[model samples]
Target chain A: MDFLLHIIIMACLTLFPLLGYNIVFGKGKILHFGQEAQSLMAVYTLWVLVVQFQQPFLLALLASLLTTTMLSLLLAQLSFRLEPDGFGVMSIALHLAVLSIILNWQSVTRGALGIPRIPRGILPSSLERYALVVVLGAIAWYFFLRRLERSSFGRNLVALSEHEWHAESLGISRKKVHTIAFLLAGTGSMISAILFPPYIFLLSPLDYNFQHMIFFVMCAVAGGPGSLRGVTLAIFLIIFLREGLRFMGLPADILGPVQIMSFGLILFVAVCVRRDTLFPKQRTV
Target chain B: MPILSLANIGLTIQGHHILNGVSFDVEEGEVVGLIGPNGSGKTTLFNVLSGFLKPTEGSVTFREDDITHLIPSKRAQLGVGRVFQHFGIFREMTLEDNVRVALEAMPKELRNDMGTMEETVRATLEMATLLSHAKQKAGSLSGGQMRLLEIARTLKSGKELFLLDEPTAGVSPKMTHQVADIIGALKKEKKTVLIIEHDLPFIAQICDRVVVLDVGQVVLSGKPDEVKKSKELQEVYFGADPTT
Candidate 1:
């Protein structure tokens, strides 16, 4: 039960961010590489509110989300072109800049030393608490994704994603849709920052690394990137690869190296074998 | 009244002049054919009129409103539907969904809600003789079907001005008739249309008057018969336009 709960928690945590990426990449046709960086920055916002200002949990979460939203707006404003490559580079540049701040802000973020004792849940059993959060988050994310898929906004996004020139001729505002998608990505990262950090009760500058950004990319890639079910399957597949080996009685030392190796190997294989399925369509037929 | 008027539109990109001081106008409910040689800036003029390109000089007035600086999407929302030489339908989506996408591009109040949206989609699909293929992905369509889809989309998109770039390009003679019929239907519905075509017969059949462009300037403006009789038009088509 505990093992299942743990996997589900990870799944739920992954669900929102992946959904967010789907909005930006799947619909908006952006390959945003800075999603995980935004998540780290969101944690820093939470840290400032909860630790330094000693704000209440809900208040701190709101403030953190606000910061993430503003960052998202800045990213969209700076790089929201119809071209995917330029937009992607702008998002990555924003992430790298945030990383610089994280590495240098010793007084606020504790720089290399890291911050500890992040406030934990009120409930005694961490498993039950995590399970509760996961279930609620899953329901919310599911409804949100479904609503997005059917709305007028979704139709406009589909038009732009498939044919920008045609969509523009029809009067679909590319900037408005892309802006909303980037903002949603930011909100997803904010949710991740709020949910995951408290569980570990620690914060470190190392957590804000590019590897984490790559992790999000890997998950998005492994899943169909634009597909909801594919993303869900990918989140589960990743959790299974990491934790399933543990349950199979593998020792930790060898297991860690093996998991890392498989991560790279799987990425390569997925790209080679599932390249068509992994990315958006480039051709007409 | 002229629904669309372009006054001395000039466009230069990277020091190369694509068009220079080209002017034309289409009265309400008129179907105008824009005929020119391969590189005589026909499509570029279409782009400028549809807001894809901002002219360095002159202005575009749609319904007497200057829209020279409006972006492509804004022009679309304001009822300027353009069909490309190549098919512009979202091939990955279902045929009904393709129409739905165009419908969604219009103002919310202008489009039918969920209750009647499907009915509206069916009506547009029927116009293209594609009602039965509503569930089929547009990518699976034949070349003729794709062209028809483009026309259906343009008609339903609530655009007052329609700029069709080589609508019958690469289509068979039968499909060309169907496309011409669709354009005729749009004209009957009183939409102002500016078509760029190389097929002289199709232009004579469908257009009220024909405009000939040579070297990015208007060389002839009259009926297709009168323009076809011009020595200058024959020379322009047979001769190279400009070095640029």
Candidate 2:
């Protein structure tokens, strides 16, 4: 029962970040460089405040949310202002910067040693308690994203993705829309950060890195870029695949390569076979 | 008062002047035809007027407000609509979804209170004579239907000024009259329209006035008959010898 509960919590942790990516970047586009790093920074920020400063979990959560959102906004502004020559290059640069910051910010993050023994006493120290927390977070996120997806703001995002010039002509500010997307993405990441430490009881820079970022993005893209249902399904499939691979006696060192190969295969097939299904085309009449 | 006025607009592409000091004006409810041979800059003028290109030298005024530097979407918000020579519909989207996007882009204050977005889309589609094709993907539409869909989407946007770049380009001859009828209906509704067309007789039939461009310069501006009869226009447009 406890093991089952652990699986559920792990799935939620994996699912939320992908949801963040789908909402912000739209599918098929590569993941931004520093997404996992930014998520890690949020987690570290909350860990420090809660453990070192003896702050309440809710207050730490709020602070972490503000930190990550502001960081994402800054990155987004820089990315937009520079208008980097290529999406892939910009993503790599951003990710590298985040990794370096977490590695170097010894005072805040304690470098590679990691913050440890994070208190999970607030919620009953049981697997069911963790599952309940996961369920609540997932439900809240779904409701919020669904509401946002239907708003005029969401329409603007869809339009921007379809044709930037056309959307601008319609008076939708692309910069503003992008900034909001970054903020929402940060907020989602923050929620994951809060829910995460309690589950693992340890937080580190290595936990949030390019590999995890790619994993989250793969889930989003494999499910469908702009689809809520697709993203949800993708999360479970990825987790199941990972577990299945492990059960089949794959060495830990080969895990990363295996994931990359499978993702590449699936993405190639998706592009060739069901491009419309994976990245459903939107219409602007 | 003129609804839109362009003064001495010039655009140079790769150091070659495409619109050389071209100027024109349209009043409310007027349908103006811009005619020229290929490479004479009719489409270039359209691009400049619609805020898609910046004129090297000249000004564009809409309702007496200078809008030459505004982006296309801002111009669209200020009541400017453009139809491209090629249909720009989101091919994968259904007809109703296309119109819904335009309507949703309207300022919140101008939006309708219809509880359902489909209702608003249906009404606009009906106005564009596209109700029957509302569920069809825009990509699957016949060329004539696509033209109508473009016009309908523009109409749904609540833009008062229309810049149509070869509205009948690639359209079947049988459907050309249908397109002209839609433009006529827009004019009757007090919308300002500027059209670029190769069909002289069609222009004569629908345009209140015709402007002729030659080698990036305006060679004539008058009633269609007068422009057609001008010796310079006849020689330049048809390459006719002066004696002939």
Candidate 1 has an lDDT of 0.81
Candidate 1 error regions (>4 Å)? A81-83, A121-124, A245-257, A277-285, B112-115, B240-244
Q: What docking grade does candidate 2 earn?
A: acceptable
- The deviation in Å at residue A153 for candidate 2 is 3.3
lDDT (Cα, tens digit) per residue for candidate 1, span A1-285: 888888888778777776787787766667677776667768888877788678887888788888888888877776554356776787788788888887787778777777788777562346787779767987787788778878878877777887777778888888898788888888888877777667667877676676666666677677766677777788788877777878777787888678777778867876786676554566431
Write out the backbone clash pairs for model 2.
A33-A91, A33-A95, A34-A95, A168-B73, A169-B73, A283-B93, A285-B98
lDDT of 1 by residue, B1-244 (tens): 6889999999999998899999988998999999988889998998888887899999999988899999988888777889888788887788988898888778776674434777778889999999989999998999889999988888887788889989998898999999999998898999889999999989999999999997789988998888877777777887633333
Question: CA lDDT, every prediction?
Answer: 0.81, 0.76
Instruction: List DockQ for all candidates.
Output: 0.61, 0.41
* Interface CA RMSD of each prediction in angstroms: 2.9, 4.4
Candidate 2, residue A228: how far the Cα is off, in Å? 1.7
